[model samples]
Target: MVYRGPYRVRVEEKDRPVIEHPNDAIVRVTRAAICGSDLHLYHGMMPDTRVGMTFGHEFVGVVDEVGPSVRNVKRGDRVMVPFNVYCGSCFFCARGLFSNCHNVNPNATAVGGIYGYSHTCGGYDGGQSEYVRVPFADVGPSLIPEWMDDDDAVLLTDALATGYFGAQLGDIVEGDVVVVFGAGPVGLYAAKSAWLMGAGRVIVIDHLDYRLEKAASFAHAETYNFAEYDDIVVHMKKITDHLGADVAIDAVGAEADGNLLQHVTATKLKLQGGSPIALNWAIDSVRKGGTISVMGAYGPMFSAVKFGDAMNKGLTLRMNQCPVKRQWPRLFEHVRNGYLKPSDIVTHRIPLEHVAEAYHIFSAKLDGCIKPLIVPSAA
Candidate 1:
């Protein structure tokens, strides 16, 4: 699949990727996911998203070939690749901050390398094709547990891990009231994971009723349609006895709405980095000294966030590109024990040839689409 421009993607035959570095491996991609962050590129919201680039970060595949230096994995190994590309020995990687590794992205001043993201994120080709070249194969890709389902393995690459990390960042205490903004895949996962972290009450806010219903069913959380509430912040305060939630999560990131000016200036006009509405709302709706975990994807540009309110309220802001590989141990346990099933959120599965339609449906929110998986080698 290649990105042509905003709202455009095409599946075309391309040269098969080969192992370029001694630490690299060639993986035959079987399953890949269309992440919500990919929408930023699909909508032209992210900078330097060039045409002809493949856009996928969540994928699982079988190792087709391995470079001479690759040791942990060999040909024919089924592996789940993490979204972040790191050298494993970098300063950040040593501290388990693989997402911020220094040796991967040439533009490392901003962020580490991410597969299939824009040029700002290292310009690596993604795994939405039949084959993908995985660098630092030993540390970045994990062997899929034999009992794990393919659908679940693919999600672990990004969405599920990101959501789990978001909840972990909240530092939730027992009986804490947690509010998550956005009912997309990450939001739902955060809400569900919050329960595992001892959240007493989880509230998911979104405009779509279908997503809200999924939040309730999948996450076992209360739901609210932000459109129905005159003031969502006020509504949250009212429910929290005017003290506000113990933790507020900004899972909606840049494309959040409910603010006309912010929407126009940020999303529509591109004057600012993606809209800061959800982050600001999280700030206003969290209690003093509470925490805010940002799992949403934001562009490299500056966003007009409510730093004053956050400071005045003494909010502990925790955020980062989730270290996908780091979260696997606990997540694997959860999956094995049936604590969570990441694949439950999949609402559409389309062959690679129909990826363009899949993108359109997901972007337009048509047919109650929640998550869409891409089968690159489907017949």
Candidate 2:
């Protein structure tokens, strides 16, 4: 997938990636996912999203080649690469904060390197291509367990891990009431993970009915369509006995729709970083002193948020890009135990040739595309 600017992408022939560093490995992608975050770049929401950039972060592949120093993985090994590109020896990585690794993306202090995102994320070509150059192979890529389904392994690379990380960030305790703002894959997984963490009740809010249905059946959570309520926050408060939810997770980011002013200013006008509707709702819907976990991706610019209310209410705000590798062990157990099936959310399997159509279908929300995987080689 080559980005040609906002809403313009095409399948173009590109050179196969080669080992560029001693720690690097070349991966021939077999399964790559089109994530919701990719939509930000697709709609031209993030800064520095240049043309001709590839746009997939969640992928599983076979190692075609490895540099001299790579001993953990070799040629022909099936591997699942984390979205984060980190060297593992950095100060943050040493503390298990892989997403904030300082060595990979020295240019940006706010975030670490990421594959296929843009120049802002270390300019690494993403795995949406047939081949990707994976830096820090020993730290980032793990051998795919033979017992795991390929679809499950691919989803574990980012989506499932992120959702589990989001729930962990929320600090959910036994019987906590959690509200997740979005019914997309991340939100669905967050809701499911909340149960594992002992959440007494999980409520998913979205505008789409199909997703809400998925939330109900898949996550076994209560579902609400925000479009049905005149004041969703008010309803949330009432439903929670006026105290509000114990935790609120903002799973929707950038292009969220709810307030007309927020939508126009953030998405259309390019004045604010990204739409703050979901976050603002989270603040209003959570109880005083409740926690808010932000798994949603926001831009580098400013956003008009309800900072004063958050401060006054003493809300505990915890968020970061998921340290995908750090969350894998628990996810592996969860998947192995049959507690989570990450592939259950995959609604489309598109070949690389139809990536443009896949992007269109996903961006347009047509064909009930809850999740779409790109089959790079059809292998």
Candidate 3:
């Protein structure tokens, strides 16, 4: 699949992406999913994406090709691709934070490089196609266990890693009450991560009844219908002895729809120009000395945050792009041991030719669309 332009997709023929560099590997994509981040590109939300650039960040595939320098993964091995491809020896990578790598993208406007994104990252295509070229294969790809199925491997790279990172950031511990906002794939995964981290109770919040139900079933987290709950905090407190949650993770990046911009006050207007409500809610919900971990995908920058609110509660705030290279291996072990099952977040699976249709349903949140797994035509 290739992007001709915004809102357009086609199954056109093209040369398969190959291992061009010494650290590269070519993978035959086995399963790929349309991610919420891809929606930003599909809806023209990301600038610099031009025609012919592939568009996908979540995928599980088999190693069909590997560069001579690659040592961790080999041909015929199953692997999951990480979103941010990082050079193993970068200063940031040495610190176990690949998101801030220095060499992955030398020409792009930013340094954090992702595949199928832009010329910044060697202009390499993405995995939406039958095959993809991976850079720094030893660091950017994680080998899936032989026993893991496609669905299980699907999450080893991205969402599941994000969930584990979110839980780690939240400092979730045994007997602590945790609440996750948004109940989307990331939210659901966050809830599951919290549970696996031994949170006493994990509550999921989302307006969609079906999604809330599925979160309960799949993640084993308690679900709350935001539409039906009069006061979400009150409801959560009832379950937690009115102490609020020990940790609250905001999976919804921005405000839902246009509700937060109703009055558009002048004083607040200047500062609230970008992503206002979601950050506020996450900051406000936690109890004294609590933690708030934000795992939602957001743009480059935003307005000033409400430090007063966070400071008053002695809350710890953690927000940054996930360093996937550092987190993927730990998450893979969790999957291999059956301690986490992120594949359960998937609610729909469709063929690659219907990529456009899948986007429509996924974007509109129609028909209980949770995480839709996309199988390419060749698969």
Candidate 4:
């Protein structure tokens, strides 16, 4: 898929990538996901999003070729690539902070290298095509276990890992009440993972009833539509005995609504960074001294957040691009034990040829679309 401009994507023939470095490997993409974050680029929310660029960060594939220095896996190996592109030897990578690797992105001071994100994220082509070039192949691509399902493996590349990371950031203690804003894929996964982290109660907030229903059924959390309440934060305080939740998570970024002026100025008018409604909500809804985990994708620009309120409340704000490869071990165990099924959230399956239609459907929230998988090799 090629980005023609804002709100436009088209599948076009492009030159197959070749190994550019000794650590590179080429993979024949089997499965790829259209992540919600990709919509930022799709809608022109991210900076340096060039035309004719491919947009995808979640994918699983079989290794078709490998550079001489690639020693971990060879041709025909099935692997799931992480979203973050990092060199294993970087200072941050040495500290196990692969997402913050210093050497990967030319714009490393701002953000790390990511697959198919935008020029601000290192300008690497994404995996939306029939094949993708993977750098630092040995460090970033994990071989898919024989017991792992393809759909689950694909989700691990971004969505599941990100959600799990978000939950981890929340630092949920036993019997803690956790509130997650947004009922999207990441939000649902965050709520579900919170239970595993010993959160006694979980509540998910969203404006869409369909997604709220999903939050109930999939995450086993109480659901509330923000539109149904006059003030969702006040309602949250009341539900939590007027003290607010023990932890709050922001899964909806930039495009979050509920504040008309903020949404219009940030999203439509491009005056500020994408809307901060969700982040601000997290700040206001959490109890004093509580934690806030942010997994939402935001632009590099500034947003009008409630930092002062957060400071006064002593809230711990933890956020980062999820290091996809790091969470594989625990997530693998969860899937093997049947505690999670990442593919259960998949609401649509689309061929690469019809990616434009899929994007439109997902962006417009038509047909109850939650997670859409792109089959690149589909006939």
Candidate 5:
């Protein structure tokens, strides 16, 4: 399918993507997904998304061919592609900071470039098609063990990795109390990561009952519907002896209303509040000297940040767009050892032809959608 225009995905006949560079590989996509970030590009929210760019970034595929220089993967190897393509030797990659790679994103991001994105990347096509060209394939694609299902491997591409990043940034540790501020896939995964990394208590706050329920079961996170409670801070105090959580993750970025106030007015999902609201809540809801990690997508520029409140609390704030390459290698060990069941977060399976409909449902939360995985027509 081709992103012929905004809010569109039309099946088209075209040559499959090939291994064009010395370090590249070609993979036949077995499972591809529609991500929350894809929605931004679909809605024309991404400044770099352009017409004709194949739309998808999450995938698990089988290696069909490899460039001469490729060393690790061979034909028929099942692998999951990283969302961001990067050169391992770049300044960012050399320092274990893969999101800011100088070679792949010299002018913009420091570590990486996404497939299927337009000018911001190298205009490389994405895995939404039958086949995809993988840049720096040996360094970017992770071979999935035979025992793991494709669905599980898929999460390693983006959501799970992103959640892991958030958890790591938030300083989640043994016996620490952690609160994740969203119940979306990434939020749920963040909560899960906290527990995996040994948090003593994990709490998740969201208005959606279904997602909250999912968080409770899969992540073992205590759920609090923001709608039921009049004072969220009070609820947190009741649970944590009024000291608040040890760490708060602002996974619901730039979309709500309460950056300065402790009180939050309930609004529909993806509406009303933005990142500021969650940041403010994190500040108000966490203990003094606690950590705050923000992983939700936000624009490049900002008007003002409440440095005063953040400083006064002595909160250690860690914020960044995901650097998939940095985390993928470490994550592979967890997946291999059966330490992470990241795929449990998927709540829906959709098809490519029904992508537009699926998008509407997932975007509007029309159904009990958690994370809807999209299967291509050919597959």
Candidate 6:
């Protein structure tokens, strides 16, 4: 699929990718996902999202070729590639902060390189096509475990890993009450992960009833439709015995709803850098001195956030692009023990040719589309 502009993408024949670096490997994509972040690019929220660029960051594939210097993975090996494109020896990567690697993107002062995220994120073509190049293969591409399903492997590339990282950032204490904003893939996964971290009660907030129901069934957490309450933050406080939740997670970014003025200035008019309503709600709903974990994607521009409230409350705000590979080890254990099934969240498997339709359905939240997979071969 190729991007033309906001709300426009079409399938087109493209040149097959080749190894451009000694450390590179070429993989034939088998399963690629339409991530929530992809919608930002689709809606033209992020700057430098050029036309004709492929947009996908979550994918799993079979290695088809490798440069001479690549020895970790060879032709015919099944691999899961993390979205982050980084050199393992960089100062940041050496310390497990792969998302901030200094050697990947020319503008390394910002977040590190990412696949298909636009020029701001290194402008590498993504895996939405049949083949994609994997830079620094030995460092970022891991062999898919034999027992892992393809759907599970692809989810691990981004969504599931990001959720686990969000929970980890929360520093959840045993029996802590946790509230998660957004019932999207990351939110649901974060709610489930909070349980693993010993959260006594987890609540998910969203306006969509289908997603909230999924939160109840999939994460086994209480669900609240924020639309029903005049003031969601106040309701959250009341439910938490007026102390607020021990931790709050904002999994929604840029295009949050429930605020007309914020939506008009941010999402509609493009006067601000995405909507900050969800972040503000998370800030107001957490207890004093509590932690707020942000796994949502935001532009490099400004938004009207509740910085004063956070500072006065002594809140610890932790956020960053997820280091997908960093969270895989522990996640592997959780999956093996039957505590998580990442594929259960997958609701649709569509051919890449119909990605436009798939995007429309998901962006509109139609028919309970939680997660959608793009199968290139099926095209």
- How many pairs collide in each candidate, listed in order? 0, 1, 0, 0, 13, 0
Ten-residue stretch with the least lDDT total in model 3:
265-274
Q: Which stretches of candidate 6 lie over 4 Å from their true place?
A: 256-271
lDDT of 1 by residue, 1-379 (tens): 9998877789888899987999999999989999888887787666677889998999999999999999999999999999999989988899999999898888657589999998889999998889999999989999999999789999999999999999999999999999999999999999999999999999999999999999999999999999998999999999999999999988988882224654445446655457678899999999999999998987644556899989999999999999999999999999999999999999999888888998889888899999999986546
lDDT of 4 by residue, 1-379 (tens): 9999878899899999999999899999999999888887777667677898998999999999999999998999999999999998988898888888899888658467999998888999999889999999989999999999789899999999999999999999999999999888999999999999999999999999999999999999999999989999999999999999999989997773224554445446655457778899999999999999998987644557899999999999999889878898999999999999999999998999999999999988999999999986456
Query: How does model 3 score by TM-score?
Result: 0.87
Better of 3 and 6 by lDDT: 6
Task: Give the Cα-based TM-score of candidate 2 against the true structure.
Answer: 0.96
**lDDT for model 6:** 0.90
- Which run of 10 residues does model 6 get worst, by summed lDDT? 256-265
lDDT of 2 by residue, 1-379 (tens): 8999778999998888777899899998999999998987787666677788988999999999999999999999999999999989978999999989999885699799998887888888998889999999888999999898678999988899999999999999999999999999999999999999999999999999999999999999999999999999999999999999999999997663224654455446655557678999999999999999998888754667998999999999999999998888889998899999999999999999899999999988899999999996554
Give the alpha-carbon lDDT of every model.
Answer: 0.90, 0.89, 0.76, 0.89, 0.77, 0.90
Q: Which portions of model 4 miss their true places by more than 4 Å?
A: 256-271
Per-residue lDDT over 37-113 for candidate 6, one digit per residue giving the tens place of the 0 to 100 score: 89877876666778999999999999999999998999999999999999999889999999999988885496999
The residue-by-residue lDDT of candidate 5 on 284-320, one tens digit each, is 8998899999987654323356678889989899987
lDDT of 3 at 324: 72
Model 1 has an lDDT value of: 0.90
All candidates: TM-score: 0.96, 0.96, 0.87, 0.96, 0.88, 0.96
User: What's model 6's lDDT at 166?
Assistant: 95
Q: What is the lDDT of candidate 3?
A: 0.76
